[model samples]
Structure formats: structure tokens, C-alpha cells
Target: MIRFVFAALLSVAAATAQAEVDIQEVTSPGGINAWLVEDHEIPFLALEIRIEGGASLDLAGKRGAANLMTGLLEEGSGEMDARAFQTAREGLAASFGFDNYDDSFSVSARVLTENRDEALALLRAALIDPTFDDDAVERVRAQVLSIIASDEKNPNRIAGAAFDAAAFGDHPYGSSLNGTAESVAALTRDDLITAHRNVLTRDRVYVGAVGDITAQELGVVLDDLLGDLPQSDAPLPEDVPFGLAGGVTVVPFETPQSVAYFGHQGLKRDDEDFFAAYILNTILGGGSFESRLMTEVREKRGLTYGVYTYLVPKDHAEMVIGSVASGNDRIGEAIAVIRDEWARIASDGVTADELSAAKTYLTGAYPLRFDGNAPIADILVGMQMTGLPPDYVINRNDYVNAVTLDEINRVAGELLRPDDLHFVVVGQPAGVENTN
Candidate 1:
């Protein structure tokens, strides 16, 4: 009876939901603010801290500094080495993690209600006082550099690097998050300390928690984790202004297979036409097996095992990327099919059925993203980080439903440019000639 009642309540909540999510904002004694969603359905609590100014803020000379700092946070901290810290958390069956993206670095924890106290203590230590010991720094640096060096030999990496360089010349977002081998080699403990000081701010940080914790308790956790961090009066860096030279950029490699990447720019997250663009992308390349690209390029012709496209919106700009992996012998055929499909979508708009199916798939797939507390917490933090209204998730389906076929067609014609398509191929083609 209780479960049934909760389900009914959730349905009501979903129907009337708006940007004002059912979240409570709590202020800790130490003055840190936290946004929380309380759910007693599970015995665990998930806490996330999104600190503004991630890898994109990597100082001109120090490309990968912020990324390394994120990794060192949990490697050791507050009177404990990495192993000791791992053991302490394992004893309580709690999970602690750290990650960095182009926009922010995040520290997360999931712990049972019974072990909240221990989890809080460890979480605070990792955030407040990291021990970037000399040996630990050297070890991590060596390992990271070794991997970057290995990538230098991989054709796929070569193609991607070349494409980004050509597409967005000097944009910081174009740089690799995993710094170059030389850059990682030059990093020292002081660089990590500087990154933490400059970017980690209580004001710039947002807190999110879900599962077994109440608003008040989660507020306390945020205070403990971030209260003492430096405060920032400035906002995150504005989006990068990126311009593309849309043409073929081929990085000749010795391998027998060719990897093709093509497309141009698109809209950012907060763009008014996001839903329209998203639904249109599903019909073009993003909807997997049901997409026109998949059907034409893979399922029907078998030119490649997998082929797809997507819109990757950055703070300043966005890019439409399409890719295919195929044999060198059929490289010409593969590129021809990709370009033909691209032009078809732009010139000849999708059918009513295609548009309808795309919208249905997108609307139906919305709730699958919130299956668990951790996923929900991640989405909440991401939306918050991107300056989206809190009710964005709850109101998503409505916006998706509001997309008209005309709106999608307009975006398709505006965004997809086969004539301006920048093609990049990374492997040697046995019989395929380079037409362009």
C-alpha cells in the first residue's frame, strides 16, 4: 500500500513538475549552501561537488595541470596514503571517486546511512587537504605520459587530434584533456596546489545529494567538504568563440583501415532550439539502429559495422560530428554514402514518419536516464553547472513534445552542410583514391 501510494505521488509530481524541482536548499553552520533531494527508497546517500573551472582553465603553458590535480585528490589526503584511504572506505563499503571534464572537476561519494559519518570524514579530507606527495606525483605522471606516448602510435587518436586542430584552430576546448606526454612530464606538486587554489571555490561550487539523506544532513556534508575553499567573485570563463574551416583534412596513416569523420558546427546547451536540434539529430545519426545514417551506411549497404553522428555543444560553440570505420578498399564508397546522406537530410527534409518516430524515441528515452540516485545526482549537477533551470529535467518531455516538424527541418537545413563538410580519414586505403 505504501509503495502504491508513493508511485501515485511520483506520477503527480511528474505531471505538475516545473523547473522548481522538489529540492531543498540548506545552509550549513559553516555557511556552505547545498541543494538536496531526499529519497528514502534506498539505504545509501550520494554526494557530489561540482567545482567550476576545469581543464579548459589550464594555464597556457600548463595544459594538463587541472586534470592531474583532480586525480591526486583521492590518491592521498589527511594523514592517509592512497592505499590506507582506499582500505578505510572499503571497510565501510563506501565508494569515493574523482573526475574532471572540460568545464568542472567533481568529487563524489556513496555510502550507506549507517556509515555516513565515516564517509563524511574521508570526503572532507580528500577535498580540504590533499597530499600531493613527491613519489605519488611522479608515479601518476609517468603512467599518464606513457599512455599519451602510446596514443601517438594509434591512428584513431591521430585522426581525432588532427580533426580538432583543423576544426577549431586555437580554441582551448580543442586541446586534449589528458595533457600531452611532454606537458604531463613537466608537472610538479606545486602545479597541482596552484590549480586547486585558483579554481576550487565555495561560491563557484554547487552541492547535490540524493538517496537516504535529508536536506539538513546533506548541507552538513557540503560544509565539511568545501567550507574552507577559496571563494570566487568571478563567473566561469565565457564560452569559446570557435570558427571552422570545413574541408577535407586527411592524416595519412600506414594502417589498412580508414576512419572517416565529417560535419560542421551546431548550437550550445542553452540554445532555444535545443529540443528541435536534438530530435532532428536522432533522425540524422544519433538514433542508433533507427537512424537514416545507420540504415543507409551500415544496415543496408554494410559499408561499415557502425556509423553515427551527434551534436557536441560547448560553452561557446557546438560541432556536428559523423564517423565511420571501414576497409581501405571501400573508403571511397563509405565517404560517398556519408556525404550523400548528409546532403539528403539538409536538402530533402525528413519524412513525416521519420520525424514522428524520432520524436517518439526521444520522448520515451527521457526517464531511462534517472533510473538510480547516482545518475540523478549527476544529471542534477550537470544541469546546474550549465545554468539550466532546476526544473529542466522534469519539464524535458514537454519541450520535446512541443517540437514541430517545421522547426526540425529549419535546423536541419541550417546546421548540416555537406558542401562545407570537413572530412578526415586516418588510415591507408588499398584501392581507394583520394578524390578531393
Candidate 2:
């Protein structure tokens, strides 16, 4: 009887060890869909907010409008001016900020559980009652304009802007997330307000929080904060597939080293071959010191300190991007090496050993990503943004394990075409051959 009890306890512990993380789907009394995870690991809490369909919905000729709107949100709201808002948050010992990137704008907050009530209250005020003060707008506009001027002088920035323009054309995603000199100057307070009203609605919003909080507490707190915003059932934009830009585009800079980007289109976020592509990319360039790109480009020739390739799949467009920096003289040769590796992978795919190492890396790194509430909150926000099922994280390892040599080769052939690459190079390399 004692032996049977021991065996039963062992089985229960094993089953618990492999159980999926319990992620709660919280609906705020105000009808907000948030992903919540309760963990008492620390005394602090992490809350992440994603306003879907970010800059892609910027209207024609209003290139910097969405970006500017997101910036002004926390600058001032309610009775608080920009300085007052800053002072209040600082005095309260709370952290709050918002920023916009290519795909989405996010606001993140980290505060002690003791301060949760006041912290979330202030956050809500900023989101719902932003004033878009005229003087503040002008000040921010000047700052943005100065930044744009600075970017024009940056070789890497020039190359990136040029590449996006060539690749995305008229797509909103192609436009600089930071407005151009002309567009930033043209934006007014009304433009910022309109853009904010259109995009930051409750229906498409996702809020995720983890650490010293319960699901019920979070639901109540977030409801008080975001419950009154207008609900939107806006339709997502249609997929815009990326195609190769026919020729090599070069932006000449007089610097000692050249920065280059090569590769064409890539897979979408929800592609069935997601794991397969993930594994293949690691073998190609995503791995740290072990990747093939680093071995050939850096280790073999001593050309670049680092080289990498990655995929970015947004609502409007998806792309495969590769970047390398090398001395101006060897930039051309470096580009050639990149193409050779590219072509080789396109034709032959990764070897069994390469494939095995990549799978191991992917699986091994999964747990490391969940070590903190902030990272866990980030993962939850990302899953909701991409429309992934809750169980996707639990099944992630199985997906990686399922990728076979045949599937890797098939995906490599279909997604990669070396000759069809759009290469962008910045700076001058003295000893390198020019293939453009």
C-alpha cells in the first residue's frame, strides 16, 4: 500500500511538471480582452498594451500622423501639461511611457503591487484624456524634424529608408515611421487627434499583465482604466506580399565600413511553415556564434564582426532581411560571400547536423524567455496580436521537433532565391568587387 501511494505521488508530480501555463482570457467589465497570468514571483507587476494595426493605417499624405499621435499621448493629458505629467509620474515613483515602431505602438508600465491602484489610474488618464497641447505639439514637431535631418546624414539610415521605399513602394508600411522632413512639418494637432481616435479603440486593443496580481484584480483595475473607450470592429488589411526589387541599390557613403542588406520576400506570421522557417533561419544566420553566415562571413575572411538575417512579418507586408557591415574595401567581396551562402542554402538546404543543432537551440531557449513577468507579458501580448491560440506556446516545442530535413529543404527552395535579392549597401569598400 505504501509502494502504491509513492508511485501515485510520483505520477502526479510528473504530470504537473509538464502542465501548460494557465493563461486567463480576461474581459474587462468595459469589454476589454486581456491576457492575464498570475505569478507571485516578485512584488512588482508588468502590464503591456498593444494598439493593433499601428502605423499601417496611416492615411495617404499623413505619413507621420500616426507616429506623432502616439508620441503626444503621454506628453500631457487631463489637467496635466507635459512637465506636470512627468513630475506627477516621477513623484508617484511610477514608470510609464509609449513609443511607436514599424508595426505597433506599445505602452509599458512596471510598478510595485502596492502602487497598482494609483499607477493604473494615471495610465488610464493618459490614454483616454490626452490633451495634445498646441505648444507641446510644436515642440515635439521640432524635435522630430531635427531627428529626421540627423537620419539623412546616417549611412545606415539612408540605406534602410531607400530600401523600404524601393521594396514597399506606395504601401503605408513603406513610408518612414518617423515622418519625413516635409511630412512632419505639415502635421497639425488636429491630424494627431484624428489619428489617435481612429486607431486606439478598445476592440482591437490587447492588454497583458503578470506578476504579483490576480486575474480578478487586473480585470477590475483595467476596466476602470480602459472601459469607456469607443469599441471598434475595424477589418484588418489584406496581406501585401513582398516582391524583389529588380536591381541592386547602393547609397554611397565615404565611411571606412559599408553596411549592406540583402534578401527578398519572406513568410507571414501565421504561415504553416513558421517553425520550419524558424529552424532554417537559425542555421542560416539567426544563431549566435554557430550560424553559417557568421562562420563564412566573419570567421573565414575576417570581413565583418557580425552578419545576420531575419524575417519581419507585419499586417501589410512580410520581408526577409539580411544585414552585414564590413570595411569599404572588402564590402563587395562580403556581398559575394553572402550571395554564395544564400544560393547554397536555396539549393542544398541545411544538413542533418545543422538541422539538429537548430532544433535544439530553439527548444533550449524557450524556457529562458519566460524567466520574468515582463518577458511573459510580452509573449502574451505578441500571441494576442498575431491571433495565435492560447495553447500555441505549449505546443511550440512539438512544432520545432516536427520540422524534418525534407520540409526544411522544401521551404528553403520556395522562400529563398539568391538571384532575386534586393541588395542595399552603404559606404565605400576599397578592395571589394562591385556586382551591382
Candidate 3:
């Protein structure tokens, strides 16, 4: 009966999650801070850590260094080889995930209360003392190269690459964090070592822990896990403007279906009108079937299977982006429909019925996201990264509900730009041509 109650607690945790989440701001003896949601009902816990300056920390020539470093984090640490590391993690019956993005690096861990210390020790080793062995480096490098190769042939990847290149030019956002085959293949162990130091520094880390942990215990754990990491000396990249102009950028590829990525500059995460924009987008293109884009593009004309849009407020830049895929023969028509809808929404805005529907769906569906401790921990870290207060969980739905019809329409009129909306279509379509 060591930790047999964990399964039962999971059910109670689910109910607790679906109702309310109480967050505690924790500060370690060493000055590190983490958000905590103590659920002693469970003998399980999830820890999530997000570090700023992820792949963007890669030095000028080392595009994929941070990504490769993140991949190798669990491959081995200190004296352990890949196989030994795997065996240790498996023996503890724990789970860990590491990922790198343009804006952030994330580490996620799940373990029983009994094994939390050992699992965190494993995590700390990966973060702080990774060996980055030569064999492991080559093995992971090959995988990166294979991904690059695959991306080259993927229409979606090609479209995204083209769009980013056009929008951000030489900014880190312009290229894939996966790096080019040439760049990834050329990365050395020294590059990874430097990347680890640059990306995992103490100053840029945000953490969230949930279940079977207290503030007192988490403070000590935080100090042990993160206090050893050095302060980052690498400066964050400068913000870049959205560089693409309005129009279709047709990339000629041999595929029956054309995939397109379209967007223009968008509002930042902290913009006062952000909640209004959030509601506006749902009515316009973000709410799946009922969104205007889908209704116009798919339900009415049957031009494409799906079409949607979202506000991508990255740390350094912001964008309103959308995508659609359709047969090469029908893609031009789909683009035309999308453009028309874009213009229509920009000018006329949305009806009252639409706004109410969006608000209901948005507010009603949010609680479902907190299905378990891991998800709650993720949301906690995400809130921290976005500079939201601890009470944001309780207040977020209110923000959505409080948005007025006039406010959302006003935001829609200002935010939606028919003139600046652009499309990067990848396929050999009959009528579309490169306008970039």
C-alpha cells in the first residue's frame, strides 16, 4: 500500500480541477520562484518548467543548437549513457518531456510522491550536468537531419518556411528551429554545451507544480533543481516587424492539394483589447465549424474541408494567421473565398448572436482544459510565462464573458485587415501565381 491511493486521488483531483484551482506563489531559499497547486489528495505530482530564449539563443551560425541540446537533455547526464539514463527513468516509473521552440524551452515531469526526489534528481542531472556524449550527439543529429529532409518535402512546412522568411527576414522567427540540414549536421558538442548554458539559465525560468507538493517542499526542490544553473549572458533577439505584404505567394509544388498559410501583424498578448480580439477571432475564424471562415469557405461553397485563423502573440512579435487546404484545382477558389470573408468581416463585423455564441463556447469549454494535474501544471507555467497573476485561472472566464459586443466589434474593425491579409499557397494551382 505504498502509494496505492494515487489512482483514487486522480479522480478526486479531476473533480477539484473541474471546479477551482488555488495557486500558491512559492519562493525558494535561493530566490527562485515557482507556482504551486498543492493537492495532497494524490500521491502524484507534475512539474512544468519553461525557460525563455529557447532556440532563439542559438548563436548566429548555430540555428539548431538549442533544439539539439534540448533533445540530448535526457539522452544522458553526468556519467550515465543513453541506455543507462533510460533504464533509470523507467525504474522510477516517471515521465519527462523536453521541447524547444522559438520563444521557449519546456521541461515536464511526472512522478509518484515517493519517487519525486529521485526523478527530480534525474531531471536536474539532465538540465545541469548533461554529458552530451559524441555518440549520442551523432545519433540525435542524424534524427534532426532526417526531420529537415522530411520538412523540405512537406508542403505545410514549405509554406510555413516561405511565409516566415518573407515576414521576418533574418530574424530567428524566419527559420525553423530544427535548423537546416547543413547547419544541424555541422553542430558540435561545444555548441550544445553553450546552448544549454544560454537557454537554461535561472533568470528566465518559470515553473509550475501540482499535486502532492507543498510550498515548503517545493521551495527546497526548486533550489536544488534550478539554483545550480548559471545566469544567462546571451541577449534576447531584437523584435522584428511582420515583413510580408498583402497578396498571394504561390509556391509551385507538385501536390494534388494546395496548403496555404495566411496572416498579417496581430495584437500582442498584453494588449488591453486582447480579450476582445480573442472573442472576435472565434466568431471570425477560430471557432471551428461555426466560424465565419468555415461557414463561408466550407459549408456554403464546399471549396475546402477546413479553414481557421488564430492570434499568434509570440514573445517578440505578434501575428494573425490562418490556413486552409484544398485540391489544386479548387485552391484558387478557396483563396478567393477566404479573402472575401476576410474583407467582409473587417468591414461589417459580427452579429449579436455570433458574439453570444462565441462567448458561451469559450467560457464553457475552458474548465475542461483542467482535466488533470499535468494539464493544470502546464496552464500554470503558461500563465507565468504570459505574466498573468495567480488569480488568472479564476478570472480568465470572467474576462471572456465581460467582453461587450461593441468592444469586440470595435476590435474586429481595427484588428482585421483585409488590405494586409496575405496567403502563401503551396501547390500548382490553375489561377494562383507568385505575387510576393
Candidate 4:
């Protein structure tokens, strides 16, 4: 009987996984818009909200203010202090999260259908009425300082910081999200308040929702939660031109293994050849065990335990970046192999067999991401942020499969820059030297 029950549960899960989500574009009376997916199978709802201009909007000399402000959103609001706010959220069995990234501030919430109204009221309080109390600011400031201190000693963090500095110079993109200890220590309640005002504006907001809710109800909820935010007049950071020349930047440290962060200019998201470039990158390095980088660097040569690459399509800049760690003596050899593979892939694209395999795996794996409400909500919001069409969820894999070998090869030749790649090596390496 137990085995039979387990089998039945698996069948149900499979059916749920195969269910299609119907998306609706909702516009509130207050002129707010949201993408919504209604699913009554679950008695809960997931909402994701994004406000453009996150840490990048921090005022001059006040870096990390946005991050600190986001962290303090739920610390207190209206009549509720931090402890009282926690109790209220727990009483409704709901979850609320606020976070700040380089380009956006995000709020995520999950609440039972019956409790959604009360939960949204609480969310509204947090969003529009955050007190940014003195004690709360100081407490969160200390917490952020602790994190900044910890990152100072992290090798990956060091490499990333150096890479950003080299690539972006004095642009906001080059600055750390968590400002220096001195800058953070100097932050005041006024900075947090101004940062909040600059970030949470109606003009920069995108929202998505999933689960047991009607479009009409969602429209009302949207207005109630976000209707009062002021229109943002603050200017976002300007585009950062790629500045790091082809070279090695060595930051001496005392570690047996060296971590290197390397990258060059990348194609924009809206470029017509983006799909082709995406497929080409998969063949070169984006694919984990099956990629050329992983195969040559780890499997055959065994220079490193792991290596990976990704495309960063940010609002202001684009990049094709990657990282690897190996013994100090072997890192130079690994770097040489990486450069060789990069050039080879640029000169000759993937084989027909490889392209077919990439298509099959990518298409098959895409649907697995929408098996839950939160994941669906996330995809919806991301689509809006990247300016994707409402039907993108259904049509994304088609674009991937439609990429031709000729197109991939052309894109690879144009996009890959083996000579222009810059490496920030953070460790004591034997053979590598500063080439800049």
C-alpha cells in the first residue's frame, strides 16, 4: 500500500509538472501593470516585484545605502517594531523578502489565499511606510559591515572586485555593493530615506504574480500595495564602456591555489544574434561537464577541479565572464589552455552532433523551471525586466532551437575575443605576471 501511494504521488507530481500556465497582463485602475499566472491547484499565491535602480542609484559618497535600506524594509513599519512585524508575518503564515542587486531592488512574498489581503497590507506598510528607525539603521549597518569584512578575505570576492575595478573604472558598476567600512559607518538615516525614495518609484517597477488569484483581484491588490509610490526622477547610471585591456592583473596573496576571473566585451540582450551567441557559448563553456572548457581543462588536462562561464547582460554593460581555480604552479598552464580553446571555438564552431545535443538538452531542461508557483512568478518578473514578450515563456525554446550552425559560427567569430580577454589572478602564482 505504501509503494502504491508513493507511485500515485509521483504521478500527481508529474501531472503538475506538465501543467501549462496561462499568463494574463493586468493593469490596475491606478495605472500599475503586472503579469499574472492564475493556478487554483494551490491555495497560496507568490508575488515578485522589481524596482529598477538598486545599488546603482545610491548617491555619491553614500555607496551601500540602497543595500542597507533594503535590508531594513521589514525591520519596522507603521506601529509595528521589528519584533512585532515578525510576529505579525508569522501569525499569517506568510513570507516576505526584500533584496537589492546591482540593477534592481526586489520583493518576494508567499501567502495563503485566505490570508493574502492581510499579508498584502503588511507588505504595503513595509514598502511605503518603513520607519528606518535609528536603532534599526545602526543594527543593519553593523550587519552589513560584518559581511563587508568577511568578503575582504574571500578569494572569489577579491578577484571579482579587482575585475570590476579594471573593467569599469570609476563607474558605479565598479563599486562594491557593500561600501567600505568607513563609508558604511558614515551612513545616516537621511541617506537611507533618500535611497528608498529614489529606488521605489512607479516608473521603474515591474511585477508578477502566480497562484489562486483572479486578474481583477490582482489589479486591486496592485493598486493597494504600490499605488502611492512617487514617480522617480533620479537618473540611472550611464553605460560603462569596457575598459580592461588584454592582460593579466596579479594581486599577490598567500594561497596554494589561484583564482582567476577573466572576461571581455559581450553582446547585448536585444542583439539579433543573441540566440546564436547563447548557443555558441553553451558549446564553448556554458555547458557544465559537456562544455569544451570543462572537458579540456578538467577532464583531460586535470589542471583544475572545475571551471565555468556565463554571459552577463546588464542594463549598462554586457560581458562574457568566467572563473577557474587551480594550483599556483598549474594556473598558468590552465590559462593557456583556456585561451587556446577560446580561439579554436571562435575559428571553428561546434559540430552538428554537438549543436543537436545542446538543443535537445536546453529545450528539455527549460520546462522543468516552471514546476512551482514561486519559480513561475520569478520567470514572469524576469521576462518583464528584460523586455520580453508576454508569450516568451512558451516561445523561448523555439528561439534556442532555431539557431543555425552558420549563425552560431558567425556570432562566435564576432563575439569571442581571446586576445582582448583580461584576467584578474588573486593568489601567489608561479609563472603568471602582470601584462598590463
Would you list the clashing residue pairs of candidate 4?
none
TM-score of each: 0.90, 0.91, 0.97, 0.96
* Candidate 1 wrong stretches, greater than 4 Å: 1-21, 25-33, 233-238, 430-436
Please give the lDDT score for candidate 1.
0.76
Model 1 over residues 338-431: C-alpha lDDT tens digits?
8898899898878889888877887787777765666667777877777777677778888988888788888889878887777788888654
Worst 10 residues of 3 by lDDT: 1-10
Residue pair clashes in candidate 1? 19-391
Ranking of all predicted structures according to TM-score, beginning with the best and ending with the worst: 3, 4, 2, 1
Q: RMSD in angstroms, all models?
A: 5.1, 7.5, 1.7, 3.5
Top-lDDT structure, candidate number: 3
Q: Comparing 1 and 4 by lDDT, which wins?
A: 4
Q: Top TM-score: which candidate number?
A: 3
- Runs in model 4 with CA error above 4 Å? 1-15
Off by more than 4 A, model 2: 1-20, 233-238, 429-436
CA error at residue 8 for candidate 1, angstroms: 26
Give the C-alpha lDDT of model 3.
0.90
lDDT of 2 by residue, 326-398 (tens): 8887888888888899889999888999999888888988866775666678889989989888888799898
Provide the lDDT at 312 for model 3. 98
**Better model by TM-score: candidate 3 vs candidate 4:** 3
